[model samples]
Target: MSLLLGVASLSACAQSPAPERANGGKGTTPATSADAPAVEAGTPDARALAAIRTINEEIKVDRIAAAPLPGFREVVVGGQVLYVSDDGRYLVQGTLYDVKDKKDLSQVGLSVVRRELLDTVPTKDRIIFAPPSPKYTVAVFTDVGCSYCRKLHQEIAEYNKQGIAVEYLAFPRMGVASEDFKKMEAVWCSQDRRKALTDAKNDRKVVAKQCKNPVRMQYEIGQRAGLTGTPMIITESGVQMPGYMPPEALRAALDKLAAEGEAGPGAAVAGGH
Candidate 1:
């Protein structure tokens, strides 16, 4: 079922939009007039870009295109795919359904982008907890002060016992300058990091420690990856599971995702808060 849906989603992306030419040029050409701004290849015009920029200044518009229905531009905002009208009058936040195949094509596109963005964070910078024998590896962006994050930490052994290697990256949740950030830095800088993380997550104050750390960089990476909260999990295949999931549920999800070979948005099951 999912395989057919995946194929259809891929097809939709392939057929999205072609570059528009101005002044009868073979390719997109710059124009001085407001009505005839240069349209980038496979993207919308300057007018649409400006309109989208006005709505959400933070949204990094990668590409813009007219939707299947006219007057709307499918805007790829950072790694979170969304759609906006060409006139910037309306914005759609949910996934677009491909009725024929019962697939969420919008989610498929976002998953591809999310995976690419996750790869930008260097693996060497993370604090890894590897199982002696691993079956799955998941990268997690976590805040030291988040309750749900602490819960996930409590199950570290269970996850490892199930052959899932948990790699931790600092998310902070609070800005880099906050107390939570400092605590995370302490944990990362400790003589024994794994122990420090356990101690901190268990509500113990880690002895003040400092060193050159990648906490800030990890936070920035999370921002660029559209992570607004703590405990965001990313599987080896680039599937994102936001928030926390119980050990048993997480193991089952990992198994299913492994079997499927791909996961779209909302395919992940959440653990308790």
Candidate 2:
């Protein structure tokens, strides 16, 4: 579900409020003061950019472009989608629906964006389970101790045998401050990360060690990609299959995804942090 709600109002294009009357109720002048010169759309565009700049600087807006709907524009902030108005006078925090398409357009946009984002991440940064030769690769956001995560791990051989390569990205499940996050750090920092990850999932000891790693960054990526639970699977094209599936069933899903091409080229739009 989308997190943005309600319309935000701004004073950018609206006429100035009428001054309070001496009598104290309120007064109204002509809605459009005849003397007001035609609004300089060029200058207002600059003002609109400046208005968007006022959003929390740390939020990291990567791209902003006109939305499918008139009077609104789409902005990619922290890899999530949002809509703002043309004159920067209103903001809508929700997904846009295409009544004719019968699909969630926001999810469509995000899937393409997610695939592009992951394409930039090198394989060395993720733990990969693969067969000698593989036909498909899937990315999963996992927590070491999550029950379903363990179940998926135990069936890794089954997946690989089916020509499904599983690449793991960390998601601590608990916030970064928790022990699980520390453990995740240890696993990533280990000289043999693949072995360490397997051991941790098998209920064995993970050698406690620390070093610079992408564990935290991966978790943040998962958050931005709309992950709400462990074992969230993402296919090569960024189709999110949330939850666990038996090896055969998962292969079937992957085959189905392979048969269908991308959602659409128009879905691919995003900016980086």
Candidate 3:
């Protein structure tokens, strides 16, 4: 069960420039003398690295190989996988849709990466909530003030009835110093956090509290996992559900994932798109 939250409040950070058409044509321009070395078929190691380096100076190429599709290369940088045209003329930052299978395999690949990252973090370091009977377990980074987060909290019973367990991690939308962060810290520090969280979500005053909490660590984990907002859900198989899902719909989606028998995370949901 993924919780949904608004990211409209968070300030946007600088990102890499979006890919653009250089020649305003259907095909790429012929390589000029100033261009990097040409990429040869079945041998993309050296030239691919050079091309990626030319495009982004900060990127450290981890691996470069032929992509599943023709005329493209898969470039792995610091564990993030992105596709680039053979000549480095185009770069794709979004998922690659498989028209034949009608699936988003790019998400599957990213799930493997997310799972690996999550595995490295200690589960004990997080604030957890378990269902009496568990069929699926999802980790979520949450902020109490987010309206969608409250909506998800209200549906907790429905999710549990569907055999989906919800686990909570701190991701105070307002960084460490904000009142929201302090309130979350109070929740984590409370002797009965479940009750405190419920109260806070309901707009009750959170008593001033402090403890050796893992809230900061969890925030860092969320960032490293590529979570940019509260309620970023991570499934047991490491697939990310970035927004909220109604109980019935979420159950059906989970059922579909099981039926498909895929070994990785499921496709991106409509809300996420």
Best by TM-score: 2
lDDT value, residue 127 of candidate 1: 77
lDDT scores of the candidates, listed in order = 0.62, 0.64, 0.61
* Position 255, candidate 2: lDDT: 68
- The lDDT leader among the candidates is 2
lDDT of 2 by residue, 1-273 (tens): 334222212201111122111121121121211212233455543344445556653343444555677877666554466777777876666667777855556555566656755665669989999998888888988888887889989999999999888999877777666677789889998989899999988878998887777776676566556565677777776676647777898888766655554322223322110
Regions of model 1 farther than 4 Å from truth:
1-48, 56-58, 62-73, 85-90, 98-102, 263-273
Pairs with steric clashes in candidate 1: 245-271
The residue ranges of model 2 lying beyond 4 angstroms of the native Cα positions read 1-55, 263-273
- Against the correct fold, how does model 1 do in TM-score? 0.70
Residues 1-273, candidate 1: write the lDDT tens digits: 000111112101111122111123121211111222247644445556776667655445544556544676665554455676765666666567767756566655445445655665667667778889888888888877777778888888898988888989877765655687789889888988888888888888799877777776666555545564567787765566635778778888887776665533334322111
Model 1 accuracy (lDDT, Cα): 0.62
Worst 10 residues of 3 by lDDT: 13-22
| Preferred candidate (TM-score higher): 1 or 2 | 2
* Winner on TM-score (2 vs 3): 2
All candidates in order of TM-score, best leading? 2, 1, 3
Q: Write down the TM-score of every candidate.
A: 0.70, 0.72, 0.69
